[model samples]
Target: MTLIRLAIIALCMVFTAGPYAEESANLTDGGISVSDKNFPWQLVVDRGKILGCVYDNKFYSLGAILILESLPRKCELASDRNGIWEQLTEAELLLWQESIEEQQATKQEANYIGNDPINDEEARLIRYLRSAKKRADTQ
Candidate 1:
């Protein structure tokens, strides 16, 4: 009975720890996993070297290499600036930075409608030009 209870408790701990704790040990040695949503992308990592990264479903190798290549450069740049590069060590930072820049540029572009104003003055000018053209055509 005691053995059964202990077994049950162990099973419960394993189940409740979730993926992070269960995966953490393997992850330190680098492991890969697919997203729960089953997206075409897969996450890859090299245990102690890489924290892990998401790659295109079809181009996992290429994506992983790209991430690995860019990481050191980004870290070097961050360290030069005396910023928090050590704590921010992850392949996702590259993707996140690009995403942030893209969003910011998109927001800036969205703020400007166009050079031409669609106000009453512009409308009046357009109407005057149309009337002038009509009168000239009639004459």
Candidate 2:
């Protein structure tokens, strides 16, 4: 009787797990995970770096990044009024700087929204990017 019950339980487990396994496999088929594609910078910044916007108003990832774009903004607002900059070591700061630069490069390289025919706004943005890239090249 026990052997028969064990077999029944195993069969039930197999049936229940099958659908979930297939569903998860389908979800993972997308190359990049959803979080990485959407908020890659936030993921790294959150690990060690603390943001004032997050502490004060609970700004979302994109909002925080927008507010804290420049080095001065980061120096002023990356921490609290007391300041967390003093807490970061040189090595950590270097690592964070590298990560930010890498993410920026990746963002610049990516086409972002699909490459449909350029609309007016897109044409304007492309013009800006071309000029910016040209300036960087010169510098």
Candidate 3:
């Protein structure tokens, strides 16, 4: 029950305090709450079959499919929120998107031979493998 409440609050914060929060689009814009099958823990917004993700640990994910899409409120609730979120510049956004694709592709090309590659926008996350960061930090 407590965990569920926390999740709900976090989701609400993503809707309220996200970068695009100032924009006209909100959670009510008609997207369904979903996490990618490859990356289930990654909270994603599915609108018309597209993805929207913004912000990540250490820095802003930058360069979403559109303008701004919140990753998770915890990404912004930090003290250096402005310093990080503000980094989502027009150029950086494109760079992030392109860089993510190229970087992940190169890393996987040796073993991956499929048309559909991986999307590591969520903390450079990979599919089917949970890392140290994904582990619970507290008791």
- TM-score of candidate 2 to 2 decimals: 0.24
- Candidate 1 lDDT over residue span 8-79, tens digit each: 433432332233232333221222344435533324233323233333322222112222323321122122
Model 1 Cα displacement at 124 (Å)? 24
Q: By summed lDDT, which 10 consecutive residues of candidate 1 come out lowest?
A: 72-81
Residue 66, candidate 1: alpha-carbon lDDT: 25
Clashes of each: 3, 0, 1
lDDT of 3 by residue, 2-86 (tens): 5674445444433334334344344333232343245443433233222333332212222222233443222222243332233
Which pairs of residues collide in candidate 3? 63-93
4-122, model 2: which lDDT tens digit per residue? Answer: 74444334333333333334232112123324446455543544553323323232321111212222112123333332312223443343445455554444444345534445677
Better of 1 and 2 by TM-score: 2
Candidate 3 C-alpha error for residue 18, in Å: 21
Candidate 1, residue 28: the lDDT equals 16
Clashing pairs in 2: none
How far does residue 40 in candidate 2 sit from its true spot (Å)?
A: 23
- Candidate scoring better on lDDT of 2 and 3: 2
